[model samples]
Target: MRVRKIQLKTFKRFDDLTIDLGDEPRKIIVMVGPNGCGKSSVFDAFEEKQKDFRPWGGEDASFYSKAFFYTDETKKASTYNRNNSILIEFYPPNAQSSRKTFYIRTAYRFTSKLNVQTLSAMASIFETRDEPLSSIALDGRLDANYKRLLSASYSAFEAGDKTGNQVRAELIGSINVILEKILDIKISSLGNIMDRKGEFYFEKGNATNFPYSNLSAGEKEVVDIILDIIIKKNDYDNTVFCIDEPELHLNTSVQKKLLIEIEKLIPENCQLWVATHSIGFMKAAQDELKEKVQVLDFSEKDYFTGSHTITPIRTTRKNWQRIFKTALEDLTGLLSPRKIIYCEGRDQPRRDGTERGFDANVLNGIFSEKYPDVLFVSSGGNTELDQRSEIAISILSKVFDGLDILVLKDRDMASGKNTTAHDRDVYLKNNPSNHRVFVRWEIENYLFDKEVLKKYCNLNALTFDEASYDGFVVDIENQNIKDETGRIKNYCGIVSSINAEKFKQELAKVITPEMTVFAELESCIF
Candidate 1:
């Protein structure tokens, strides 16, 4: 079974919200937005729905209690009608069967404790043998429950119960896999004495028997969540696992790795819903699950209403990578560059044997004093630059105001006086004023000016005759050095035995307003 849709009406902090999880089992739904934008509120709505939910063949309660309600407590004497409700639709795995719909209307209460009566109802629902389905909600209090359940399971396993032993074995195996892959440590054994608490002993090569309690807080948090899922795996089919703030107490790296690991623990029929503030987790999930993941941005602006809107940012399977890249860029402040210059290559040595600095560094070195607001970013390659331009433009247009974005490409092997004219026409028609291309074959070719080369050799105290250098340049041009990148490397090998990067730096220093490429760059930026 899978959640097909959820509709919230007058719910806490939500006037009207609908989330559509596509009709597919094993889907991962990710909720993202700024604080107070109703990310957690969506999870709360789901939890509310789960409280009184029963399977298809289960008995219904005559009376259901509501704890939380939407109300204005400050206006006690005033009259207002408040009806808060959540409606969720679920589709059974069988294709021929119709979808199952469930809903609940309740008051809004801000409390951490679970309702005892509701818990009893949930217990009864799970106890029913026919069509047993389970739901697990995880928040901040995972560590305490993790320890209690883990210790009890280990004790039962020690008592020689087959079921307890199976649970212990499964938990240990899963935990060890996570530890090894994420932390590079193996679990040699799970240790326990007659009256002593159980602990995990980690092994690394010759190093063995490190206690579980010795793990860092972040590691412990990861283990806790994974263990909680493992312990609860047997109780549910078509399960719904809701995790709010899964990144709690974890660093960026752990946040990413833990989410990837958690995905493995989810059963094939189970659906996972995550509410996260960490871009790291979002990015990691996107990479791991790809199109199986759905991200809803609750903070999107509704231009028609002139207020922030709650909706899933529509994306296709092919475009999800681009969407997440833009989101991650926004989260990390990469979009803060007022004037973004898209270019090829990242931190490769220039033709003049300069130290490794990609287009961004080269442009920065030359243009920073003139245009401090401009930020040059390497797109890793020319093709990537072209493919990602639309996504970058779309995301930047929404988040940035008065921003100037441009793309700079190399002429490559294509012949044209205006090297970037075709690309500008094809890709930059919307912002033609901001796009540019190097006059020469590539940025490396532009750095090979005779005057610049002569000056660079002299400054570095390298022995090179100006007449010989002029002859070498003429020969290279005569040979039609299309691969300027290779030619630069070869030129550096002949000119200086020292680092080629230093020569590129010297060339960058000598670059002046007279260079045609520099003039074009200046025009593109302004």
Candidate 2:
């Protein structure tokens, strides 16, 4: 089933939005936009329309569903429960069950474990419903998919007198075909069901007999979508297969291949709808499908007061530029950096609202003006940086040819060796030439240098207070407070409650060409 028209008013992030696909909509509808651009809300409208609707003390109307809208004027912003705001029109003009018309897979998709106690019957399409609106609702399909796979395989094996593996191959051979073609991997076996180890086993490269849980997040995503479609395609023949953020955890190359494979797997009568900011997927949909794909630029729509209509835009260079900006934002211009330094610490924020990528941010602030195109990334701790830096450099090199990537780490202060020339030589001899160690114990230690602190005090128009500063440094050295971040915070708390951001700014201001610390950093980074 294809959606011919959609009208939404006072929905999430949409005061009013309408999309009208004339008599025949394209086979594939790819909604491209930045995050929170009402793409997912459009899918929400479809799911909500299928719910069983019953107004207060009214009769049950299964085809009709309840939706929320602003009943108390646009200014008050008071939301009320109602069922009149959302309307979805099907091409066939017949009401179908939620499962029969719409097969939805939300963005948050993951399955940690699959332990099968007994085979469960698959829900009939007529009785099945759509997923909840919550994006964090995990896609618990792997376990159920496994049960269905086993049941189908067992039936085929018994009726046709086929071998266990052979019967299973018939059920999942198409899935394996796509997996092998895109990821260079295939399902080696469906582990023995009698032992309750019905998890999927895969074979890739030299690795064999690895459990389904061992697959990468991207690999698991591809497997989950392909397997589910293969098992349920017949039941949802004339359906609008909607996948929100299908490129989750997948790289650009994999996303392109996946889009092609998904289009092939969808039934001939069914239409595909996807909400994504994936450049690879969008490019593939346009270049490959051409007229068969409708590119709805959600980023261009007007989401203001009254009703507004939106139609597919031509995939022109201008249109593409806008989409790319929506997808990458500020990073669009820096897609290919002159140099990338993989340093220590996390790139993600901590739960307590602590700033992440501290090392990278500091380095960028110091060198941005001098080397404008150089990028600093916080890969992880020392060990993780050693491993992931190589992988990142390898993959990124393939994507952006001749990309200069390097690794940087802190000096090992656990040995109690002073920051001397001899120690620096020893560290360099043991590590790769591209992987350099800081002259200081860590990056933060540079901020607390006697000269840098004096410069900071002068810049802030405060007294030097050399006696107190020297005593604190001696105490820290005696106590062996290794965490330079904590040391900075402690000292700042005592003197003046300077936050990390302000501390970094003052530290950057003090790091000049005349300072010996500047010369040391230059030697290591350059």
On TM-score, the candidate that comes out on top is: 2
Clashes of 1: 12
Candidate with the greatest lDDT versus the true structure: 2
Candidate 1: tens digits of C-alpha lDDT, residues 126-232: 44332212122223333333344556566677777568558767656766877666666666555553335345566766778876666666666666567556656
lDDT value, candidate 2, whole model: 0.72
Q: Write the per-residue lDDT of candidate 2 for residues 1-526, one digit (tens) a residue.
A: 7888888766655666789877888889999987767788777666665444311221222212222333554344334433566767877667454546777788877876666767767775354332334444566776777777878887888887898777777766867888886797899888886887778989989999798889988998888898888878888888898999999899998999999988998977789999999978976875666657887887875554567888887554446557778888865653346588989878676698444787887787676544545778887787788898889877888888667889987775334555565777786898777878776667756767767767776776666667655676773212333445445444433365556556665677668767887777888889
lDDT of model 1 at position 446: 51
Worst 10 residues of 2 by lDDT: 54-63
